[model samples]
Target: MTQDTSTRTHCPYCALQCAMHLQPGDDGTLTARPADFPTNRGGLCRKGWTSAEVLTVPDRLTRPLMRKDRNADLVEVDWDTALDHIAERLLTLRAESGPDTVSVFGSGGLTNEKSYTLGKFARLALGTSQIDYNGRFCMSSAAAGSVKAFGLDRGMPFPLTDVGTSEVVLLAGANPAETMPPMMGHLSAPTLIVIDPRRSATAQAALAGGGMHLAPRPGTDLALALGLLHAAHIGGHTDHDYVAARTTDFDRAWEHAAAWWPEHTEQVTGVPATQIRAAADLLGRAAAHRSAYILTGRGTEQHSKGTDTVSAWINLALALGLPGRQGSGYGCITGQGNGQGGREHGQKADQLPGYRKIDDPAARAHVAGVWGVDPDTLPGPGRSAFELLDALGDGGGPRAMLLFGSNPAVSAPDADHVRARIASLDFLVAADFVLSETAAMADVVLPTTQWAEESGTMTNLEGRILRRNRATAPPEGVRTDLEILSALATRLGQPAQRFPTDPDTVLAELGRASSGGAADYSGATPQRLDDGEALYWPVRAGSAPTPRLFLDSFAHPDGRARFQAVEHRPPAEDTDPDYPLLATTGRLMGHYQSGAQTRRVDELTAAEPDAYVEVHPDTAARAGLAHGQWARLTSRRGHTRARVRLTPTARLDTVFVPFHYAGEQAANNLTNPALDPTSRMPEFKVAAVRLEPDPAP
Candidate 1:
């Protein structure tokens, strides 16, 4: 039944970025159905199945706009006028308040082509060092933690499919069933090690399928990780050969773990001592197999202690001499589609393209040469997301901002503060398919093309580079992200000449920057992606990118993984007398972050149109709340009211909310702003709150 419609491609909903073929109906409807591929295997999630509808939504933007005054409504404007407005404002701002007062905010959703070019434009043209992106809240901690321990921070050093062969899988802080369900074929056992404060859908699926659920207290994953590593020491599981030959300061790391044995870590993590020891033994035994993968996810990354938790996870794997082998290594299951590639391209505040730190002289030289700019002129290591936003105004913050493909108003940690900062901006422009919550606050909104109308590439969680081919022509007035960047850059008189009017040229620039770097993509040219099968990263010239990582040598300086000495820290907010319950938030299978695109889809909207708190019956009873009834959830940070749904899925004292809804029901509105000092990510997973009946009204 297969036809010759292989010319089209689509993006997988998760970070795996599995490139797929789109065979439009004979009548020309561009709906995407799964096609068999090596990585995806014809398996797609609910989100991916409906992704095709996103491009055809009725509210999609289709023209440029500008507003003359703060209270004035947006007026239709030509592309020239819009670009000119942006350029003139930038020039005026730079002259009046200096370069530091203006900055840009990029997104992980942007194509690798768009992402890398934006990094270059910011440093070379704007000459502002305050640029940052939304990824700082998501990818920074995982990246920093993995690099500190194993010297690499993409998802896995090994391909995810290798998880099936392992004896035991540590499902710590990750919910693949909901996050990336298609990959579950990698797990052969139901009794994989599941760790989370909340027995989420992933844990529940594992339990129903006969898996082990190790429920730890919120914000204390580091403790359980410490306990397991300590058990590795006591159980004689430590790889002394790998430690001494391939690692540094073995004695110091062991001593650090010994100081907080399983018993002590039990206190911090709320897991019994016996359970901790048993889990460690299980991991050690399973690791002996040919392909065991330790996967980390958002549960471990979105907090301030995010890095340390990631390091501990990697340390546990290193103790067994796991990494740099076939399927036995530490990996992170990145959330955003381009979470890996986005960070690699330097959209982050503190890095350059190809996973190099901004301050690194060699990396600076490499990137500057790639961009054809003076290395000295390129600013290095700007503030992270929170700091960049907090720096707006008096202490020299970006006065003007250009946002693309993101809705920060609903998605940011403390949205009110983000709204205020955007309001304070001298000029703001947003380019998206619709008037997203963040875009609603913009001085001008430019209609932009969606995934179906764009052609480029995205790097997945497994480090696979896949094609994103256009399935349909963009709307009459809409344009691609690359086109927008190029046109706007030209208006600024510093056009991205190398990538002008060509996505392939932009990809070439990204490929060139990947040279001589850890995430080499020279072989991942537009040509290789054109081939049928999926290829993993570390792509080199005239050769293959390694399908799975750590087949031989680790990326660490010594070619072996290091056991990090990680201690535990509690979540910033904890339940007390007034806030006597714990609250956790995450995604729903029916909706995505901010719900801007999905909510617009009628079918998706009907499935879950409103927000509700998942409350355990016992907790709901104690709080005078009932299923299908409204209740007020008050947290240390703020409060929100939602309809209650009694569900056994939630832990006794914890209430769960989905972050997809906006307005008063928005979970971020009630979430704490205290960030993981290390990751700068607002702690969306854990907060302290109390619930009560929504007063008689």
Candidate 2:
């Protein structure tokens, strides 16, 4: 395509979803230029710049592959052959083991239309309730906390521009410098307070600019938040009028906070009372002027007590009277490209389109009507992502599985066990652009179109929906996910008309399905998106896009946010004698979620050649480990070996590992599988592990 014919799209990697222009070169290569989008004003991360390289990667899947039997090798097959084989096996499995024996797993990376269609296909075609997505591991805790406190969930209710307007920005467990480098440009707040265990890139950047960094112990975010709130309450920093006017359960929440004074919290969190008080003072001053924001990310929300930890932060926001203000409130720094819209448009275990509860009678009838199905025939919520994976080989669990986009074998916590579970499945189908670790063992793998080769809508971290125009055509033999879903649904006896291959047609259905629910998107038509306008959800007809929310009230019936009385709880697997160091996992600057697509990019691979453990100098010396020395990290679940990188960034009692690599360096192999009571999130951020010097060559 010529320069003038370039298509405007967004990055396919992170939730920042920075806008960019793509021109397909005659030589089959693609060029990307930063678009002056509001979220990222004409800026792109390294990942975004190199995103096009993935489009023409030498190993990009161009044809479907299927294995004839358990011990057989995967061989290339035609689309029809692959679909028919998968359909026949699914039908046979359903007949032999019942509908509940078929499960579908999805990803947050999918476009809004694709996610909606996947959820519908699993429920209507397979008649199974065991459907969930990899997003459950990403930001479900924040979603759960938002719903509980505000009766709804949107990553950032206000626009990203508000970050620069806020007087004080308190970022909890988020390191945007490495995760979303473009976002740091918006960090113009006078006082920035970052809470994290490690001296992360974001923390260091903030520190360099005179911002404060509170290095709390790993898994102690809840206690840290409680401590901050308690200090604020004691210092009379809380807005009593705002609390009384716009919230409930204040007394109980205050009582919970009172129990954890700064001293007690210091014991639990390892953040000093003086630092807590200073943070409280800054937040209080900002709150007095109605200019503060409390934002969270996976670092604080990927724990067994993730939901409660998020709730504690929400309580602090509510106490400060942040919500309902113009530019101040609690928000989640969503990690996936479409994570906000993915969960809202369905694909979550307990949700329907429009962010409605699946078990709710109104939601059931509304969505069922949109699908032309009987409401009574619809199933209730099923097991969460990890639970479903754990049950794959069980007698009563699903026997056949269909996976889309997600690479759980590399991404899931306790991944070694998850891989074994995948191996035990009677049949498996994977639809992806590359042969991810999860796809390698699948009974069938279907080649699918990449983001730039397709047209769809993706809701970014700000809850803004933007159109992704097709910049180029996919290689022959590969098909869009919509086409694959349509063909597979038809082969499984569903009417072809019900599952159209066009993304616009699917989005139309999605809008209708989401019409009146909490995250209503009825106003977001393909025509509107095609017009190059950005729109946030709760998009009702005849109304303007909601760039900001809760100006007057929340989504709750009482028109007020709720104050959750959350208490501090230790992580499921705490550091002890055998496993004396707290091990936390996170993403690196060069890799996205699982390294499935990013690892294939030569530039990214060159930047982050391999995974390594970040060890505190004290801890490294104690273990007789030197920098670049290979070490073995052993946890209760499993162990992995990686080279040790000594740094003072890590706490003396903590070690950090990047979770991008697989095999012997897989970080998830040592993570805990304990679930958060409310969010069902795995404790990926913290686990107990011991570092041992690897054998010398």
Cα error, residue 103 of model 1, in Å, equals: 1.4
Give the poorly placed runs of model 2, Cα more than 4 Å off.
1-3
TM-score of candidate 2 versus the correct structure, residues matched by position: 0.98
Tens-digit lDDT track of model 1 for 1-697: 8557644565645686554666677666666677766556787777777887887788778888789887898888988888888888888988998777778888878888888878877777777787778777667778888777767776766666666667767877888777677777666453477887777778877677666778887788887887888897788777677767666756666676777687888777778888888877777776665345577777876776888888888778777777776657777778788878888877887778777778989999998898887889888678777777666654357788888767777777666666677778878889888888888878888898887777888888778887888777787988877777777777666845744657788778777887878877777777777865566777877777777765565677667666677777778878889998878777877787788888987878898878899988999999988799988887765677789999886678788888888877778777776776766777777888889987747
**Model 1 spans > 4 angstroms off:** 1-7, 26-28, 188-190, 393-396, 495-499, 695-697
Top model number, TM-score:
2
Give the per-residue lDDT digits (tens) of candidate 2, residues 1-697.
Answer: 5338777889998999999999777787899989998888999999999999999888888999999998999999888899999999999999998888999999999999999999999889888899999999998999999989998889899898988888889999999989999998898555689998999998888788777899988989998998999999998888899998999998988888998889998888888888899889988998898888999999999999999999999999998889878878899999999898889877998989998899999999999998999998888899899999999965358888999999999899999999999999999999988889999989999999999999999999999888988989889999988898889899999999999989888888898999988888889988788887668877887678888888889888999899998888888977778999999988888999889988999999998888899988889999999999999999998999889899977889989999999888899999999999899999998989999997745
TM-score of every model versus the real structure: 0.95, 0.98
C-alpha lDDT values of all predictions: 0.77, 0.90
Q: Cα lDDT for residue 105, model 1? A: 86
Q: What is the TM-score of candidate 1?
A: 0.95
Lowest-sum lDDT 10-residue window in model 2? 1-10
User: Worst ten-residue run, lDDT, model 1?
Assistant: 5-14
